[model samples]
Target: MTPSETKEHSPMQQQAQTFGYRLLKQDGAARLGEVVTPRGIVRTPAFMPVGTVATVKALTFDQVKQAGADIVLANTYHLMLRPGAERVARLGGLHNFMRWDGPILTDSGGFQVMSLSKIRKINEEGVRFASHIDGSRHLLTPERAVEIQCLLGSDIQMQLDECISLPAERKETERAMELSLRWAARAQRAFSDLAKPGQALFGIVQGGVDAELRQRSAEALVAMDLPGYAVGGLAVGEGQELMLRTLDGVLPHLPSHKPRYLMGVGTPSDLIKSVARGVDMFDCVMPTRNGRHGLAFTWNGKVNLRNARHADDPAPLDEQSSCPGARDYSRAYLHHLVRSGEYLGAMLLSWVNTTFYQELMAAMRLAIAEGRFNTWAEETLDRIERTN
Candidate 1:
């Protein structure tokens, strides 16, 4: 039988049969589970590195896997703009085009269409906007977003839903939330019609910061019974406390049988907090972006590599780090590279930060399995905050 025909007996089925979260072990809400997909299985409490375009900026696919990423997120907005989804499809989809065989999750471009585009008009039908790259005009509706992800052959595709900014009036938030729900329904219908075996679609719940509205949105999406769910619109501009509270409000309403993803959030603290609140997956660019700026994440908080004190320090970034850049490179050498404006500086730091982020996720999973997540989290944060 072909791969699609055998998908039910494949690892993806094994994971799904055990529930979207195949609980290998659990420590409180923290869990170590496998998220089965047609491409491969991803470990829970996982951190997916952001590959905005086809590539993960400066790093090779092999290097990315070596850094311990089970999956990576690609932007539909960027890819559709440049290489065009059709070109990627002609080159054998994103996996072969990008030369990475692992599973990939593609965002619906809804967020970018609203935030990055120069001109945008949103209606029940879809969104019309000018491309940020060259001011090219394009229309992205729920159906179009689904179609683009299908062309890219993503293992997991997100529904195109409206994402509104926070701290807005009640009426505006409700209007945006209602629009997102309607778009989500259309996206789901489109996804179901086109979904091939081994591919899954995730519904997004959007309500800005309103708890009642968040619950309403979650209830509406859950009723459709998509493969998974994502909590969006929290990390846009809200403070950490509010973000966590919003998650707390919506997570309980999400179906437990499916995976829960928190979109575009945050610092290390945000990750820990959200995981404790029962988030299963996350994707962010902080690690790579911050790394490129000479910042490093260590067990002892974030360190700026450009500091003068590092000029004479002989210690590595972290002696116990499994990553070469973190364990083998000295503070003095890294500082010199940063000061000299060498490209290697950004590359090494990005690698280290990526490694660190993965390591942090692994540690959280372990702590959860050991039933010491709270203790571990507190201690970890204390250590990081002390020296930062």
Candidate 2:
């Protein structure tokens, strides 16, 4: 029987019976929706923080939750390499291992095949690569990828797809896209055989920057009718214009009822633009990564705490902000902490930036629900571009 036909909920999935998406509202091409998992509900247009290795770097799980994240993403390739997927499963799954009860999404590690791995080769079966840490050899097939994600007990799991960098020849792009489609089918079969009732495996659309190839990939994946679809292989050196153009061409082919995720996507403006194109979910490391470098994202635009201009600026990042790191601490203090390379600077700024991203998602949801997303997006983008 398929996962959907399973008679009992898996012990790992608590009260969750199945995965679903509910489209609550829309404005133009913008959408407001909820991704329902057995674990919890994720409101869209949602921004999930990257918790690579089951941690969001400097921030604690409580800080992540308090920052308003409904989900966190983990890296499958890294985990399978290090602590190992079996080790995590033996430790009672990633949620138990990491102590985060909210829904978790695990990337199939296709991106790492392009990055991270110092040396690698691709074939019909999967990728064979050396571990970045210890130079150990490992093979990651689509079937093995699905099994690894299943072991983690993630609420949402991505299909293993080969991600290619931009500025490549049409033939090269087409070859990678077709390979990803074949892998998607393999992933689906494995998921059907191994996944629990409440878990979901999403197919990814990969076509580099070629619009026609993108549509071809989307059409084929949509035919599979997976739980969700993700637009992958972008945001890897292609500028904003081509990325948006590709989305404009390909998104309509995807089913409206299923959630649409744009993988490894971008900045505040990128999210706003992608939302306008009807994407439902996103995950990126920009907020926390930039925060660790003393950059804070606020409504007033980017604030670089390393600047001497803020050395005496007694004002908080945003006194009107809800997060203490943003509202309570002065810029002067944060600047001192950051310039001095204090760890608390990373912690507090990470919290502040994370909270800001969640706040942005909440704002987009409200705007989409109220039928004014276009206007709100225009105004918000303008405000965000002005800088600090």
Candidate 3:
């Protein structure tokens, strides 16, 4: 009958039962947990590096692992267009294709669909668009999205959702939210048709910035009884305070046993705040994107390698960092590489930024388990500010 009803006894959740999460500890609204996937187990409060198109930009799979990421995310849109999902599946699926043996999460190409608004049209069926890459036309339906992710063999797959841009009227937000619910049902049926036991399907909650709408979406998606849930549509220009507030509205309705993912979310500060608000997973492009522009994330804070003040600063970004790129390289040297537009600059900075993010997650996990997250977060934020 309904998506929620079918989800209870679906084949997807029946056999393997491998895709599961365990709550290890909790501190206030914050939680500590572990997600067991077919590939491996992802420790809770984890920050997954965005590996769009089957790779984290400027870094190899080994480097991704070295950066402390137990899992990474790939874009269904890009991979489907360039390499083709069928081709990837034929060549041993995403794990072997990307050469990353750990867990992988794939979106339903929904964000890219929204981003290509100029070239796309949405209907009850799906969205049709002209690819930004080669101007080729394509149609992405909920079933097709599920099929593509299934072909990619993602350990965790997101449902195809209609993500509305912010600053919209209540009616527009409601329309998009309702469409997403319908798509969720279609996605569930498609996912159930192909998903194995070890894999999972995650439904996204979308209602723009409207708190009431967010609650509605959360309740509807939660009714689906999916293995994981993601809070979507908030990071689209909503300020940090609103984002956290929106999370507060949705978190209560979500199943505590399931992992909560916040898509394309934010800066270091955003991650810390989201975790404090009970989010268990996050994926963002900030760390590497900022790194390529010569920004370095460190224990002390952010370092702008472009600043002339670092011309002769021989100090390492962080002497205590285990990453050689972050601990061994001098600031002056890094400044030179970045200033000169050298490829090495982007690579090294990406490595360093990734390392720092992982370190942040590790620190939070420890603090939450030890029951001092609030105190630790306050002191750490102050330290980062002072170091900056």
Please report, in order, the local distance difference test score of every candidate based on alpha carbons. Answer: 0.84, 0.90, 0.87
Write model 2 residue lDDT over 1-388, tens digit each, in one string: 1111212211233355889998988899999888889888888889999999999989999998877788999999999987999999999999999999989999999898779898999999999999899999999999999999999999899999999888899999999999999999999999999999989999999998898999999999999989999999888888999999999988999999999999988899999999999999999999999999999998878999999999999999988776899999999999999999999999999999998888888788777877888998888888776667
Candidates 1 and 2: which is better by TM-score?
Answer: 2
> What's the number of clashes in each of the models?
2, 1, 0
Give the TM-score of each candidate: 0.94, 0.96, 0.95
Work out candidate 3's RMSD over C-alphas.
7.2
Better of 2 and 3 by TM-score: 2
lDDT of 1 by residue, 143-171 (tens): 99999999998888998888887789888
Tens-place lDDT per residue, model 3, 46-89, is 89999998889888878878767788999999899989999999
> Residue 300 lDDT in model 2?
78
RMSD, every candidate, angstroms: 5.7, 6.4, 7.2
Q: List the pairs of residues colliding in candidate 3.
A: none
lDDT of 3 at 186: 95
Which lDDT value does model 2 have at 94? Answer: 95
Pairs in steric clash, model 2: 16-38
Q: Which ten residues in a row have the lowest lDDT in candidate 1?
A: 1-10
